[model samples]
Target: MHDKYASVVKILHSEASDLMSLAILSGRDPFRFYNGADLTSLDLTNQNLTGLNFDGADLRFAHLEGASFDKGSLNRSVLDAAQLHLKDGFEFNYQDVLQFPGKEILMFCMIRSSLIDEILIDFGINYSVFAEFSKISTGALRKARVGKVIAIETAQLIFNGVFRFSKTLDSKIGMKCINSIEQPCAKMLVGGNNKPFVEISAEDVHRLFEIRRRRIAHMKRERGTNASPYVDYRDTAEYLMFYKHLVDDIDFWTKFDEESA
Candidate 1:
């Protein structure tokens, strides 16, 4: 019952749909405080909704065509058959990989690196800047607790996470790296239209990965550190786009989705 409009809504029906309609007519979003509210087969097609909380609510067979799907709580709402335009980063969840495994999360990384490279290039970042991103991403992959077994699904999640990290660095840490290179290493880097870059061959990046892989292989940490020459720059930059809110599915009135989540 609406505390503010209970008197006005007294004449209205008490069913979920009737209450939902009253709530809408009362100029408030529909909210079911019970996260487990079963809202199966509600004719919610193409309706602009607000104040709707669907956290853990069952929306199976709900008609949601052309309506924004991110406006409610869907912590674990059944959303398989809903007609919605979902984006990749959303991945059909509240901007998280909460249900996906580490392997599946990592799978997205296979193409993530390349996409990052292209975008950086588009932004006029050069080899030095690119190398910094590469180093950061590659090293992070090694230290990630996602287990040694990387699969497509897991990689995608990891890759998306790393992609977000790079964006963050671009604003925070990338500037420092760019400044340092422009000062002392300007001559060694390739020059973009508006940025300078370092000389990093594909082989160099590959070597970095190889080093990270074998760093902990067949040896003790002390011995490895003493004899091995692998360098990891995980702290320099981090990936954070995966399991994050990329876009869409923004249930603002519900606990199902989170902007920071």
Candidate 2:
């Protein structure tokens, strides 16, 4: 199977824009076939690319709009300015709560749990890779994994590490559109007049991260030598909501540049 996929990749590389190579991958797991392939500027428009694994693929400027990739993995793939179909809306719920213990320790547990690791997995990347890009350090990442109450700076570091670092060209363009334009872009609009709902800049995310850190510190201090700190549910809820929106905003913006173009 591996050899077959390797052969397919060789063919794909030779015929960079060949639909026949893609047709050969129809109804099959295209992960191995396209992984690490130089698919730059490929015209994948309206293709059924469901569940394709594009890890390490250089898809810069690829046309991906109208394509379906509901289960595809673009992990660590370069998609500079690649057009993609954006999601209609964002969804968040308790199911996304990572693990148990409920809202009180949601944020901490999210950090402690496999959240970042899971994200890295989707990106076909590892903690060390994220550390190198995020500059948060492996030790600090480990501490975060252990659910330690990280400092405010570290919190911002983690946020930047996940979202800001290693951004594709489209991500940068989308963010610029959001920041520069006063009019509502994409689904980021609100009311009938299409006013901007919110502008969650890197600074805004950092502020939320700081607020979350301060709340954790305050809760720990209040506990005061008794035992473990009780994470406040309300505080966690507040930050988590913003965190969800921030994620949605990023996702939307990544696809937003194409619409503006």
Candidate 3:
């Protein structure tokens, strides 16, 4: 695979004066270890990029229509103004190893609340939460005896109540809360100023999950007693959106590490 890629890279470099334009017609599917390479503004329509590692590469303004990125690592790669349209069953594994360049702010906008929660919880990071209808504050709510508040972002909320602690120490207390449903609640510490923290109750998470379950149940009932194609496709798309950010974040962090090293 390495030899094939080396040949393609040489061809891409020698054939065309414009390297970006050369990559557009390189006919190199599944390029191996293509890192920090500039392929900006290339047209990669209907390309099969399965298992491609675009770590620390620039793909700005590239055309990726109908591209298959199943199991690809796009860590810390730039996709600014790039067109992306994937088919069904696109699998992507993204973590903190990816990064987004040229449009860092826009990349954050694409991240989902569930993905953020997964990343933070896996890393054992502390987060603050408030009511479902309220906001999260790091200062004022530290004094409240509410249930577990895991993490609070602008769009989504997470909580788990499985433990508790006294509110006496000079530092903030981390604990859990158990509701009548026998579910675990999460309370955590977050960053912010003296603003009031909106606490999302443990019941809210259960209720939201329950609502989603019922919605899917109803769809299955209407579509068929066995399965609903639309629900499956929708769920797949939602999952893809979450994975995209993970890949982007991983790429960003990897680049940071290299630069610092």
Candidate 4:
């Protein structure tokens, strides 16, 4: 573990300058620093990140297999490509108790797919159909919309789900899936309201499915190696089940089609 820590520290220190701008050094004392930094693509495998408050940090592509975060705070941290595993008979808690502060929040609790789908339809902010799933010439579309750009909040939700369950899938496939979801979501928010109605490309949609594939791979691995049954990340499954909710929100805003001032 010491060796692992050394490697992680070296990488962080060397690249600290570049990352400092992206790092969130908030609060004070035990929970008073670095709440939501972006530490993506760093190798922190098998190190002890226990009790660290990474409450909204982007830890995508970080190697954390067998790492100890037993009591660490990752409330809203992004773990898209991170690897996690339990140590000798140790049980890891995967509960998402972190409160993400925002208005356009997207919550996905574990439940049946049908129920999730219904909930998404009820809360979505856009009216655009998931073009990838249905034909462009489908029946009449719904007119409900939310008229606000909530992509950032929604993206974080998606990232959290990918990170929490990434370790279960094949590394390559998992990374691809995470990138698929994270990229467009990030892009949508870059210009904010200026590009509110930006369409997600076909490539991006494919990436979402890739996430599903990787999830299945992870489930199979857990069942075959650990004797545990296949369990998908309830959060992610729920989000996908009710993704249309976000679509509704976007569509509503587009109906007005007023440019951002």
Candidate 5:
């Protein structure tokens, strides 16, 4: 019986190692190998079966005491009359988050509570300027601040606004800055095909004005302009991009917690 159990375990590992690894990393299914396998009355005692996928497998009257497995190894597997021992400390199920009935609202709230302010502060932008530039309605912004769920269309508008504003800023700065230099040139980059002059767009002046507002806000807190992160001339001249989005909120948040820990 012991020899038979070892052979079965070896064969399963050989066939499904990659899939099991993927499932563990992604919090997804890894049961392709044992989707419908029968291992009735088998002795798997004291075995190390961590991260294995045993979905749809039969384990009736199997001796599984002291066998080690990850939180999700036996998901969807049958365990009628089987001796089992499950360890603790398996909290925060990604599946539960996915199955949540109010997940959409939760996502919207998260964005409104954190992402909007984060983007604005990172860009040194004021609420009014951001609203005007992003074309986000004042009402919608107010609703978002109070934790009210905004429409999907409004959320999309905010995202597009961030993307477009970043791109426009990049274009303006790129035309002004010289190669390998942080500051913009004195003259605009246009006209004769000689040495390129920096093209200071109207947007540049507006950004500088916004930076001044940011500096003023900092000064009110007794931090002063010197304490501001965006006080340098390069701050207005430099271009930054925002190119990423949250595709899997659960996965993203989980990774965030792990890294912070």
Candidate 6:
């Protein structure tokens, strides 16, 4: 069993229409209506996310190991590189089509989908408040994915705001069942190695925000000419490792223990 972070996901879709105006009015883009989800590096480790639509989403590099969900959840999604296992004790690793070695060098690299959900769900956040921050155009990130390549900063604001813009809800019947039983969710992130990582703090999330805000502000002031000192960019491997460590630390081996028992 695993923590799907599904309750947190409810924050993004709970009451989208009421807050659309504020979401549209804030930050850089002032008039876009969208509320669809695109996730990569999402840790759906042992939660039920049945029937969730992830069309046009980049689910590359997600940690789905030991997680259970209907296949329908990933409808029309891009799963270029993902770690998964439908059964207990199975280590699933998938490689993507991206990142070929260049110039006679033998190397391979991949990426997470870069959605806001992917970045924060692992922090054990209860996003009930963000659901009401503003109504979101869930389709905005998909638009950015298909229409124009968005700046990393813009994507951060979009995904982060979408969640903060959401409100948490009562757990679904299935989620309640899982919680009531105290079924421990797998603590590992999607990667080659299965290990528990570290626990994240509120400061870490806020730190990410402050860095992005300052960078975005500076980009606006300088007209997208230079990089911000505060923003620490993680390459694909590093990004995966950060999650791997974080996910690994959270009840990391519980699933394996269950399987071996």
User: Which candidate number would show the highest lDDT if scored against the true structure?
Assistant: 2
TM-score of 1: 0.27
Worst 10 residues of 3 by lDDT: 175-184
Q: Which candidate's TM-score is highest? A: 2
TM-score of each prediction? 0.27, 0.32, 0.26, 0.25, 0.26, 0.20
lDDT of 5 by residue, 116-171 (tens): 55456555777788778768887786565453555434544555566556555555
* Candidate 3 off by > 4 Å: 1-32, 82-261
**What would you estimate as the lDDT of candidate 1?**
0.37
lDDT string, candidate 4, 39-126, tens digits? 7877776666643456566777876666665232443466663233221111111222123222322222211113213323333322
TM-score of 3: 0.26
Candidate 5 Cα outliers beyond 4 Å, as residue runs: 1-32, 82-96, 99-261
True lDDT of residue 130, candidate 2: 76
Clash count for candidate 3 is 33
| Full-model lDDT, candidate 4 | 0.37
Q: Is candidate 3 or candidate 5 better by lDDT?
A: 5
Q: Which ten residues in a row have the lowest lDDT in candidate 5?
A: 178-187
lDDT (Cα) of model 3: 0.36
lDDT of 6 by residue, 92-121 (tens): 111111111122111121112332343234
List per-prediction Cα lDDT, in the order shown: 0.37, 0.46, 0.36, 0.37, 0.43, 0.34
lDDT (tens digit, per residue) of candidate 3 on 51-145: 35565578877777776553224433656733332211112121110221211111111222233343234335354533211344544233222
For every model in order, what is the number of clashing pairs?
40, 1, 33, 16, 6, 28
Residue 46 error, candidate 2, Å: 5.2
